[model samples]
Target: MMKDLQNKTIGVFFGGQNPEHEISIITGEFVIAELRKMGLKVIAVYIDKNGIWYSNKKISELKFFQKDYAKKLENLSSCYLDLTLSRNKLVLHCNKFLSRKKIDIDFVFPTFHGLYGEDGTIQGLTEFFHVPYAGCGVYASSVSIDKGLTKKLLSSLNIPTTDFIISYRHEFTSNDDSLIFKIKRKLTFPVFVKPARAGSSIGITKVKNADELKVALALAFHYDTKIIVENSVENIVDLTCAVLSDGSKIVTSDVQESVFGSSDLFDYSMKYLEDGGAQTGNAESNLIIPANISNKHTEKIKEYSKHIFKEIDASGTIRVDFLLNKKTGELYANEINTLPGTLYHHLWEKTGYQINEVLEKMLLQGYARWRESKEIHKDFKTDVLNNANQLKLQHHSE
Candidate 1:
């Protein structure tokens, strides 16, 4: 590992337009704190509910973001990543009269949970700028964010996954009865309706009958244009495993079983609003570490978790959720979170690695990946532009 990153300036981006905005803030703050403790120069980048990007040193402290910081906004500056090849920097500009300033960020750690932040948008920006950033790349983020797409891909690969049906907003508005009828005919009752491209259980509902299904679909549609209705596993238990990938080697953490307190399923409150919520331990949904399961089952989940990490081409840290059918003894891959809450550091800690250790490793790995990318041959030996001109002449003759 590289000995020092003292000179490097790292940007921690958190909060977004999605429903999980507050949760993202907490996650971002936690990461910022960790980076600071490591004696590194950290920049706190906040994305508000309006999707406006701002940078402020005050953001490094949790108090500054507990409520609306409108009064303090004047001190902060609006910023955007400068993707121009000339520089891999963050451009912060405010008034037209003031000259624009640029901050060179050695690395970016995105803590945004859903939508634009975690769904490859931020990663795409970093990749386009040729900057090193932690977490999954564009392809992995895009593939894992869409629940319907994840199910299809996993099922196609012969990976166990619950059966699901997808519905678009237009189709629902045009013919609700048709979509409802198809779902009922294809799957049994007690299904889950969720926004296809959502996280933190922001827009999810459990439906026991057709009437409830309609209501759930309406709620889910409000959050996303596309919705997914999946067969709910009976007498099921939720399990999650964290995966960390560094180049060729991939490591999976101990399995965790999430137990709900007041709800039958893990919802938004259980995930973010509860005691110590996602920032530290269990949160509202008490998580059992090294999940109580047979040794064989434990190994199976870990194996599947590692496989999904590789299959998605994921880097950095990823949390893979699993659902086990109590009656059938079947374990199904639920979803992959490219940027899991708190980076699932709690799980890793229980598995023998501290949060800081993981973060440092990830930073080094990200830098190495960036350096390796620079060595790749991007230009072709053949003169493609000249050949294109000849092709144009040939096309004119034809």
Candidate 2:
């Protein structure tokens, strides 16, 4: 399968009109490098924060974005996807007159982390073009991005998850007291307030008391319209496991426990800015693989990770987070990241697979899913359109 892909061109899409744009760029470059190592033709498709698409070979290099990168935009060509069903190509428009180039893309590998790109938007675009793409499909992407929706689905399936209450910006604005009352009635203090649709630990606040609740909600609302307030688990240990699938079988990676700082919170700084910043893939030492837990807990986490992946109809690779309560020895599903940072290759690496191997499996699974979708009868013979004139006449009579 890897050999078959070698001859095909894959578009590695990253960066977007998202808060996690910088992180996405890192993941994108990592993917491009690994794909090239496999002898695959790769195109770096970069979407700026303004939502403008650009293409340049230089984008494959991390240094190309540093030191006044905005000025470098002129060096890159503006590009857009030619979503015509028959032609899955990326159209690059150069600065020169009548200068347009089209690059045929056999597959799309999305390294986007949050919002516009990861929350079903980019996936939907590829689906419209009938193009095979990596990561979860529209349904899975949309559900997994919203923390509130994910918890609701998990609860429905009897999957244990932390208790959470959702608050909309409009509701909070209209009746702050009522919303606060509802939150206080349902959840206890020291709750974690988070932007429901945001990631990278951005716009998250660990509210310690009633006095801090309002401030936390405001911060969360600044990032997203909906906010989720989850009860903070006492003596919590943050554990994450990665899951990969080829549309037939599911595999779980070794569970890793994230060591937190004095704040006891895994915020944005802890995730991307701890070590040498986002450039160095964060601090490796902060993540302890084969987490310091019993065999039973590890197996349970692995089981839950696989179950969540399958239940959500997810494809490709994903990272599932769980909050372990050391005091009570209880585990609760925190959230699911359909497109985890750097595809959570670190966890998979510890699980006996290289980054290239993981990417290969994702691309193959995407192709398989696309092929299966094509088999479904989309052009069903129907008389509804044929009776248009009769239907119009009946409507006029009415």
lDDT of each: 0.83, 0.85
Local accuracy of candidate 2 as per-residue lDDT tens digits, 189-297: 8799999999988999988888888888899999999999999998989999889988777899999988875665887887888784432336777778889998999
Task: Name model 2 segments beyond 4 Å from true.
Answer: 83-98, 277-282, 389-398
Please write out the lDDT profile of model 1 over residues 1-398, one tens digit for every residue: 44546787888999888988877888899899998888889988888777677776777788997776766765677776554532454544433236665666767889998899899998888877777888888999999999998999899878898888989999889999999999999988889999999988878998899988778889999999998999998788889988986676789999998887456688877676677664356572477888877788789989988888888888889998999886788999999898888888889998999988788777877777788888998877787666578777889999
Give the lowest summed-lDDT range of ten residues in model 1: 88-97
Superposing every Cα of model 2 onto the true structure, what RMSD results? 2.1
Can you tell me which runs of candidate 1 are displaced by over 4 Å? 81-86, 94-101, 282-285, 381-384, 387-398
